[model samples]
Target: MMLIPTEKRLDADTPPEKRGQMRDGVRLLTYWSDSGRIVHGGFFQLAHQLEAGDVLVFNNSRTIPAELKTVDGIRVRLSREVEDGTWDGLILGESSKKLEFMHGLKALVTGPGTEPPLVRLVFSCSSSRLLRELYRQGDVIRYEHVARSWPLQDYQTVYASIPGSVEMPSAGRAFTWRMLAHLQKHGIRLAFVTLHAGLSYYGDDKWPNPALHPEAFSIEDEQAAIINDAKANGGRVIAVGTTVVRALETASDGNTIIPQAGVTSLYLSRTSKLTAVDGLLTGFHEQEASHIDLLQTFAGEEGVKAIYKEAVAKRYLWHEFGDMNLLMRQERS
Candidate 1:
């Protein structure tokens, strides 16, 4: 078993704090996957491993400019919500305190809301200038967790575009342009789809449950044609992130995939039958979160357990910037 560095092994002797630290954040587990075979390695070998006729698909949806700032002793954060408005919600403060000084409005933001519809904030503030100021600083934003301030880019993927994702789709971060070039040189092709990530609420301990978050998307016809052509020609179709998998699968009609544009609250797990994606490139998902179950479906239960056990034993890192896995398709029944 290869132990990922970020994990704390719990074989009936782990401590509570260590277990809390260990739960599902295992990283750095690498493996070679074909229809009927699996091999272990460090993650740095992927670029030199793949061959021609393999198509890698990526999600270009960007993370939103969101930050949790304090104003007048009130905790708040920015987010894009629904029904035509941006929500600058209040995260901390007495629920019945009726926030003082907010001129018939809330000036503090919490729980991240919609981008534009007249921001509803707490406290008495003149405008939403603070939120705009954070955006001006090269898209750097922060969020408070328990007591730590996690950097916004830390929650972002390298290919992030569209400034509306409160959180980030993390799988593509480890991929560099060099990796892309390596694949191209080896005759591997690439395609992209857009599935703007939802806010951090899905992972926040306050919610702790996979929020029924809705996602916005825009896919081009050329992208669909590229995917279809690859599949028809018997090339491998690799979904670069779980976000891409959800977007492509949701848009698929089992045998046919059509270009789609809209918002969907699609929740995926192992029981969810896949439609278009034949393989997946993804990061480690937190325990019990929806992504884990979804990945389990592709990895196969025993395969996933073995891979994770090996990764944890190998001392892999955890979280968004952690390592990745390649779950290949089962070519034969």
Candidate 2:
């Protein structure tokens, strides 16, 4: 496992807005797979890193206020909604067969979930009612590193329109409207896919396995056509986050992407071969997290290790509010 030095573990506790900085001001680390070259710059320089024919695929999943507190002060983080309308959630503290929340809402712990600390919860109200109550009583899910509570709006991307992700698909957080307009003006295409990201952590140092934590994703016909046409015409398909990569790879059939909507538990690692995506722009992940494994798929083990080492030495911040990394394959000859 790649180890992140303690000094390099600094958290970006404040959002860019709170720091009075533009969203695109975050630092970016770029890695070219073919040449093993790394470049460091601000996120606003992203347009200059790609050619006019390149397409950036973004995940439009919006963050929801997923952390709810029980009357007894137990924190419940909703993971995802199941087909039966019940939610799979993580109980932060000791849990029982039943949980009581404010506003007279209650939930029955149906059974154990797919993993520890995860339990199936059947709320006393309907899904829609539960969502409304969540907005009324729920707060944005914050990890221990976040210094204070921020508004739910702070966790959403400028282009986010669909509301489903429990946690923000945060890799796209640094993108600004101006940056997007500049990219489009420079002839770089942008496409969006919906991937309602699930909870990344399971409490108590436990993390969800990407292969087991199935997230729901949808690719529209037009989006698929854009990606395929880009690839067909020698344009690179750059995934904005691992969520977009997972969605595109899941929808792909031997290098061609077919539009569809479904749940994906696809896990990519060094051993995995990417069939659709040519590059990735993502946030720095924890050392042991599966996200590191996904990065290996693009840059290989040694290459990823080198990139991480450089990032740490540069004092780049870590986590959702942290700096960004862009890994791209070399252009076709």
Question: Best by lDDT, which number?
Answer: 2
TM-score, each model? 0.73, 0.97
lDDT of 2 by residue, 1-333 (tens): 656665667678888777888889899999999999899999999987899889999999889899999999998999998855599998887878899999899999999776666788999988888888889999999888897998898999999999899999999999999999999999999999999999988766688887778888999999899999999998999999999999999999987999999899998888998899999999887676687888889998888889888988898888888899999977444
Score candidate 2 by lDDT. Answer: 0.89
Worst 10 residues of 1 by lDDT: 9-18
Cα deviation at 315, candidate 1, in Å, is: 0.9
Backbone clashes, each candidate: 39, 0
What is the C-alpha local distance difference test score of each model? 0.58, 0.89
Return the top candidate by TM-score: 2
Candidate 1 lDDT at 225 equals: 85
